[model samples]
Target: MLAPTHYPLEYHDLRLVLALVRGGSLAKAADLLGQDVSTVFRAIQRLEKALGTRLFDKPRSGYSPTPLAEALAAQAQQAEQALARARQHTLGGEQVQGCVRLTCSEAVLQALVAPALGAVLEALPGVELRLHGGPGFANLSRHEADIAVRLCQQPPQHLVGRPLATVPFVLCAHPRLLQGDGGGAPPWIALEEGPGEDPTGDWRRQHFPAARIAHSAHGLHGVAQLARAGLGRALLPRWLIEAPLQVLDEPTVACASTLWLLMRPDCRHIPAVAKVFEGLARHFTTAANH
Candidate 1:
């Protein structure tokens, strides 16, 4: 058999194939994979190219796996089981001495996790941090991450953790934006949609139907930067702002996903994971109350 890397199929890619076969449709597979349809499509295409074989037979009803895919899917499930066993084995040392993989949206990492890590790194010199940030939530079940800082009303059913904070988006604008002859609502800086449609963007569109777009950005940090540069008013999460921009009096419920400090059940008891988890919990709790 080819080595794992030479095989070129990753754990997530294998799961995607299984998900597509089981879900029977692109949408359903996307849901199962915790990704958008485009992403699922792209990943499958990439996998097929890597293997130099078409794994799925396409038809109107839905995606159906071929013989090669069936065999691979079986292997994938076996790999998953092996990974679970490996999970317990890999995390045998003190969490403080080993590496911890953390996943979160860019906004959370920059505003919360990144700022707090200085203390964590200072206190535990042996601990290594591998921060993974993106638009999509990483799959804890597949060992994509050891911990996740998620912003959602309810945490996913697969993970377990505590509510770190109620992160609410508030209207904030640079002081210069409010300047000039007539005082009026500053043009809005719109946060653009990602792979999965952001519910908050729709909420903003509905609530402020007439708002003008002064700028647009794909990430919260970009939006905050634009607002700081006096582009326009921006609805930013409360924790993301430190200074220069001020929260406005305008009412907004555009987006309010709770911050959750979560870990896969299988990975949580590791001493190092536990220690870092506790520190993150304390940091967010303090940020929330303050």
Candidate 2:
């Protein structure tokens, strides 16, 4: 009883073997490999010697692959396909056929950006859009996202984009939320904190100094949700106010927040990024800059 020996196989050798099997003759295999017939013959002999077995039967008509050779040829085909798949993945980002991650606040994504997604997809056929909605910002310098949509008066100096929308804040409450609360600013549901003089604390104080505070929430959506649940009146952005939650009064804070489309300098030239960015700007630029 004896054990068959194992041989270390090279990728180049497997290629030649597959070529020989598929081409059915040494001359054709050499042509496939861009080598002379003698070189192909010598390489096949070396492979056979390494395996301690004859791979082909050299009949007068042509070469016939043995059982071992057939198995090895299948392995070669599998290797070819595997390499092809890997190549596709490697080349994925070299073109515009991959995904683009977009980060923004949950409120904005819901109110304005989310609805316009259909148009974004229609324009960029193969580009995938990954939307992440949260409070804290995604770092563009680290490539956390391809783009960011947010409400800011002064966007970070490192990022770049024009103002998308000049969203205004209005007092809104659910129809049954505070019907008979007896006016005097409808009791306030305010944001916990935000940028200078207004957005949360100052705006509430300056506008309705004598009004009572009903509830306070961390994020813009949370503040709106509090109002939606029949809690109290909330000062909210125009985009975030939906049905049932009717405006208690006209917008008092014009340009309370400006929607800015920010992106890293590196991604500015990418076709998908540039195209989507312009599309978003156009979609947001309407007659509603109040």
TM-score of each: 0.59, 0.57
Question: For model 1, what is the alpha-carbon lDDT of residue 55?
Answer: 84
* Residue 50 lDDT in candidate 1: 79
Q: For candidate 1, write residues 128-242 as lDDT tens digits.
A: 7777887665567645578988766676687887987766788888878767648666798887765321335766787789888878887777788898888888877876665
Off by over 4 Å in 2: 1-95, 175-186, 194-198, 210-212, 250-255, 286-290
Residues 1-290, model 2: lDDT tens digits: 11277777889878978878866788878866779999999999998888788888999988888887777787886786566446546767533444567888778778778887788678667677867787655556544577888776778788887887666788888887555756544667876665421354666687668878878876788888888887888888766787779986554754376778888675665556766787787777753453
Residue 19, candidate 1: alpha-carbon lDDT: 75
Candidate 2's error at 112, in angstroms?
A: 1.3
Clash pairs for candidate 2: none
Candidate 1 at residue 260, lDDT?
80
- Which candidate has the top score in TM-score? 1
Q: Please give the lDDT score at residue 49 for candidate 2.
A: 88
Off by over 4 Å in 1: 1-97, 118-126, 134-142, 180-185, 195-199, 242-244, 253-255, 269-271, 286-290
* lDDT of candidates 1 onward, in order: 0.73, 0.73
